[model samples]
Target: MSKTILYARVSTADQTLDHQKAQAEASGFVIDEVVADHGVSGVSTTLRERLEGKRLYDKLRHGDTLVVRWVDRLGRNYQDVTDTIRHFMRQGVVIKTVVNGMTFDGATQDPMREAVRDALIAFMAATAQAQAEATKEAQRAGIKAAKHAGGKYRGKKPSFSRNTFQVVKEQLDIGQGASAIAKLTGISRQAVLRIRKDPSLADEALKRWGE
Candidate 1:
């Protein structure tokens, strides 16, 4: 029998921990112990930097199974995730994913299986790292654009609350991505699309405060 330890993480404060826990439980993983890094940014992959992340390395022992919701919970990038998993396996710890039912251990000697698993891990880790980088890039771009564009965005008067439709139009004009604009403006992306679609609102802008 294998002792499973559930690990869960969420990127932001807005996200709830229950969702990740429920997903792991639903996948038939017995919640022996859960280590979570709540409201911690995923950009930092170091275990010591994360809240409960350090506990994972300290509490987990050899012959113990580490169950993660996905490979991303292990680390942020390809090298980090792969290296960490490999190191744990070397330490006699087995790594498992609740979502995929995949396991990585020292006993597996099949070259093809190892290759495939490595490929999958690489792909997912790359995605996680890329996402973090993309978020950083978007924030930088938004700040730069806001300062450059006239009334596009200002610290004094926020872009959305100042002129919702005009801000949307300006963001559209600046070629900012919908999601990036939505996140910066705190307005629904759908609203940005609607404002873009309907030019009539361009002339009659709303007061920018309502439900």
Candidate 2:
């Protein structure tokens, strides 16, 4: 029997494995299994690179359903996302998303349907990549501004390390909640909020403390 597996890349504590499972269930997916990659950066790692993500390749079979929060969860960039989806579709796996309840079925023989499905996949994949790039650019700009200011802005050093800030920024880029990021990084929610509010300032603080 084919099973419906819910896959999630949970980088934060708030969105735990259980939370993801519940989210899928609330979205009407009768998930038989849950596959999650914890503390994984969706913007930096390809689906195949993730420990749990790789398992999907081996665990999934023809006719099984693979459910994700969105298409972005399947890859790190436009090309990667599109390629991964196409690969899975070719293998006869039906891909579904909790958001928008989108479905991509490879079982169809209709040319029109296939074309539409492929187009949609391309659009969503590109959009995901675009969003990631925009977020990255914003953070880069912030860092640049902070560095140029050169000790002009002085305050208490941020509670997060450079690594933690990068992780938080990545998760933010992928649209993860601040509270969730705070919980995962073991920092205050306000700190996460502050980072979100002004990433450049956060970077400057990190630089001041040599974190």
Which candidate leads in TM-score? 2
Candidates in order have lDDT scores of 0.69, 0.83
lDDT of 1 by residue, 89-132 (tens): 77888888876687877766899987887777677778878877
For candidate 2, what is the total of clashing residue pairs?
A: 0
Off by over 4 Å in 1: 152-211
- After superposing candidate 2, which stretches have Cα over 4 Å from the reference? 12-15, 152-211
Error of 2 at 134 (Å): 0.7
Model 2 over residues 74-128: C-alpha lDDT tens digits? 7658888888888888888999998889999788899999899999999999998
lDDT of 2 at 123: 94
Candidate 2 yields a Cα-based lDDT of 0.83
Q: Which ten residues in a row have the lowest lDDT in candidate 1?
A: 202-211
TM-score of 1: 0.63
